[model samples]
Target: MNALFPALRTRTDLPALRFGAETLTYEDLGRAAGALVTPILGAGRVAVWATPTAATAVGVVAALLAGVPAIPINPRTGERELAHILGDSMPGAVLAGADDVLPAGLADVPRIDVETAVDHHSPVSAASAFSGAEPDDPESPALIVYTSGTTGPPKGVVLSHRAIAASLDALEEAWAWTEDDVLVHALPLFHVHGLILGILGPLRRGGSVRHLGAFSVEGVARELGAGGGTMLFGVPTMYHRIADALGDDPALVRALGGARLLVSGSAALPVHDHERITAATGRTVIERYGMTETLMNTGVPVGSRPRPGSVGLPLRDVELRLVEEDGTELRAYDGESVGEIQVKGPNLFTAYLNRPDATAAAFDGDWFRTGDMAVREPDGYVRIVGRKATDLIKSGGYKIGAGEIENALLEHPAVLEAAVTGAPDPDLGERIVAWVVPADAEKPPTAGELADHVAGLLAPHKRPRTVHFLRALPRNDMGKLLKKALPEALHG
Candidate 1:
């Protein structure tokens, strides 16, 4: 509530960020961000060409300082999607890095090029000082983050400064995240995981961060080993790559094993990868649950051993509940019964920009309907089943979670990647189908053998009725499996 970041007013001389070969001290960042304020002042909303660079970070910070809403545009976004976002947000201006090439949609908007280097041999004044105001309004929208709309067109989710503050505070409390920890990752800067948590999270804590430009096993190993990174953040695909290479490279094993914390998000990290990483390095990767609307809801407490396929407990101040289809709450944490996730807390988004009907429908009373399915243990731990629409396979009078069968299939040594979906059937209502990428291409395991492996681990009914083999599963930029793309991928 006290201006979102108190560290900006007090901290200086700390290593603020390291991106590629560029380095910045806290003072440098303050000045660089402060310089940007005058150029983008009085803009109601601004668009950012969010490339994974120092300029993007500076632009976002500058927008926040000016108390203007910043909408981050993915660099690789298609022109069609870009056009829609531009038409929707109607930003007053667009900010991009010095060397960035923007799409045609942004040609009409005023453009401000970001400069990362600025001499600041002195401390920076409070951001509120520039506007001649006491402080920015906490409830005012700070960012308009977009969701991957599998249900419909992409919608802009407005996040207030208060929401961002609440989430980061809860995360700090839950992870014991201190200013002394140096965060490291190679995630894209457009998304919440990489933009807010990876970059801004460190800045808010008065800590430093190192970005690898792109993810590589070598980068992760080298950074943690000698780059002085203490905490690591990545998506499942990044971790999956590390897990796959851990046995061959002792450096990767030693790097992960020696790091203080390793957190995975953006998708479910396969249980097989978790066990493999832990087996080789003696370190357990932490999994946390969050969406674009909710910054972060739950995480495995820092020191606790992460349960396989579980996202652990709700974060501090986040009130979570599971609900039945009828909208009644499921109060018991019996661990076997599944329900849709409903949340009530300060971490909730303000609105889905310009969509009152969607925003109103998003909440049932004070709780936001998350559309995700999960089972909660008696101890309050959460095991995500899957999404209600895509993953909840109701077949033969049994509610089968595709995630469970996916996990079971991953346990088989021959299986590389597995995704499950339900197909309509005349007799059973829906039949469980498995799409897999085998570890061995020359001689892939038969569908019956994979199904048998699942049956042995779980119930027989949970096994896949049919199998489809592919070279790789379709995924978005953040590594989330695209279940809706399954039908199209099958024919491709």
Candidate 2:
């Protein structure tokens, strides 16, 4: 019965969640979630208004308690994407906070307003006896998380209870996690990094989480300095802000230095941020790699030495392998040979919901093609180069990774953020073009200077042939640079 949330009932007296001014004890959450059983049970699928609110957490937890497949819709999704998700997932009901105003597209779906209260009490059920009804099969779909539609329309990834359980358990083991650990993050509730890992990871271990509602450097310092949080999780943007503010704030330096582990994911944290954080706080920021299809494939274990930009070893029970472009498996772990990563494990989603062809294409035999390009160290640690389609740039006589050159540009004091892409050129098959956000717009570094910086770190051929300056790089809610949407957003 406790397969999905192993510690839901057992962690009764412990403080379970805090978002802004609202707080919920484990006991309080149990009753609130229990009350939702009647409404959610028997419903095959539901939708959640994924806002950074306490009610959003309650609604998701309630759906999990009732064994219903919950599809979390990003609150900021565009009209077209929102329409696509609504039509594709076709959830029976949509759960929203009491204050959320329904969009015109969601007018047809039955709406359930989740109460934001957390102090209501009820008799604590036995750990084995909680809930409305348990799914007879653990393989029943628990969540239908939609993918980021970079190539085409977004597809719903069906995650079963068994997959969710395997993922959280493996993370617990990898991080040496326990109930004593207090997690802190201000990420959104729509994606895996925020919803599954940020929310469910702590609950599975009977631990506590303090959600900041929204990320801010001040919020981070306030919580870590006096909030008693032992571990912190964030995307690269959040870390970038922290790194930028560290030189001016002593409290931030102390708070970050005192934490047990600092994790960065969703997108790679620039190597410069890693160095800045380490230099200021003596804390090595850890990075992990995963996607919507696979909750978590690899991470830096709590006690391990963090290789600055590497995502570290594959998690417990996850098997990761690198394959060449032609699909042959690469057996050598030389730390420099790059290949596409394919994973096989219990932590993968069952299939892309309702798309048989898409589901079939995602897997080869038993391994799921991750579409990410990376190299493996001799010690089995993995280092991601970039994605196969967009981030792999073949220029001149060399195949280069855009992520490496972007990191090099970020290392320059004049650059704030950088994204590298390939543009067709007559000389070099596809030349490297960099989109840069300068630290100081009025005194921005010249294109030649930034190109020289990349050439200095990497090679002469790997440097960007042209540079375009922007006020800010277009990014999704999860801090992933929307490379596909860049031209439309930047040029037009």
Candidate 3:
């Protein structure tokens, strides 16, 4: 019912967005976004070329202002995946930068160059031109974000304006976010972590954001060390690189130490990297948990002591519970029992676009089945073990989480990267297997030594029965491990 970005209404000289060397003041952004409302309005849905550019932000904001659902397409998407998304969403037109050369998939679609649409000469009041025209229905579809399609074809997750508003407000409470803060990140613009939280979150708080365009240690140091940024958001891979460079680059440590908050999401942050970063910089990298379907479910509250390997507590107004395989709820939170996480909250997707069956199957009454397995401590801290399908391993009459094994493997001095999964086993029902990237190529750690290392840290039963060496583990654009893409020869 209310405006999503209140800052766009009033004209101000304050910097609203900085992408690389280009900076857009609040007034400049409001005028550019406002000028394109007429072209974007009445379009059923628009596809945005979500590149890390200021034009992409202007296009998405223009679509939102016109009350049309915007579908963001990743620029680096493969031809097949790009075709699938375009065919599924079927947008009326594509909004992209003027200089962008679209692929064959988007060639037939009408294109609106956002850069040329700006009317800098005319003073178009955003308050009167956009938000003041009419109040939007809270249930109206605002965004149609697609899933990763690891299991099947990517399904479009339809998120409502109410859900987005609820998510940002809850995060404001959890992080103590305000207008004075300047956020910084280099995350991609396709997923919720970067698009919803990184971009729109700052807009909602009337704050500023400085995007690195591409992630680099020097960029981070330059921005934060110069006192231009107060907060930082990154994925585990980015933080791992930061930890690796902290010792060599004192400037990097100083910049990170000066930041008010450093947040990591999209994948689990290993405790080894966490300790390494903290030892160098006094700031702790806070971890939060969420999915494409759910904007944000839990985060560590601001001003609280950071807990390694834990995703703090359930966010404000979010009801989270663990459930057994039989669908019964588990109430005991002694921190050892692992179960699938089910959640009920305002910050949830309306449905999978054009898939009624999937929409129905995803929810049990008001709660959504997340398919993530986690253990909850008595104090309400949530430590995600793994996915229900890939991360949970049934071995020797015990349920073992692959994430725990992976975390323990990362602690070894010889292991550079690790991913844990299960293979069919006759004796143990399912044997835990560790796929490792060794720090040393010529003299890698022996399988027996790595297994013993894990057994000493965790229980003996949780130790990997097989260890496969690799130069590098498979990862997606967001640095999330792709367990399904692991070598099949090792399993055979």
What C-alpha lDDT, on a 0 to 100 scale, does residue 14 get in candidate 1? Answer: 70
How many steric overlaps are in each model, in order?
A: 0, 0, 0
Off by over 4 Å in 3: 116-120, 131-135, 488-492
Model 2 Cα lDDT, one tens digit per residue, 51-138: 9987778888888877788999998888899999989888889999889987888998988888756444444343423544767688
Global fold similarity of model 3 (TM-score): 0.97
Position 192, candidate 1: lDDT: 90
Q: What is the C-alpha RMSD of each candidate to the true structure, in Å?
A: 1.6, 1.8, 1.6
The deviation in Å at residue 13 for candidate 2 is 1.6
The positional error of residue 279 in candidate 1, measured at the CA in angstroms, is: 1.1
Q: Report the poorest 10 consecutive residues by lDDT, candidate 2.
A: 120-129
lDDT string for model 1 (111-160, tens) is: 99998887555444444334443145788888998877688878999998
Estimate candidate 3's RMSD in Å.
Answer: 1.6
For all predicted structures, in order, the TM-scores are 0.97, 0.96, 0.97
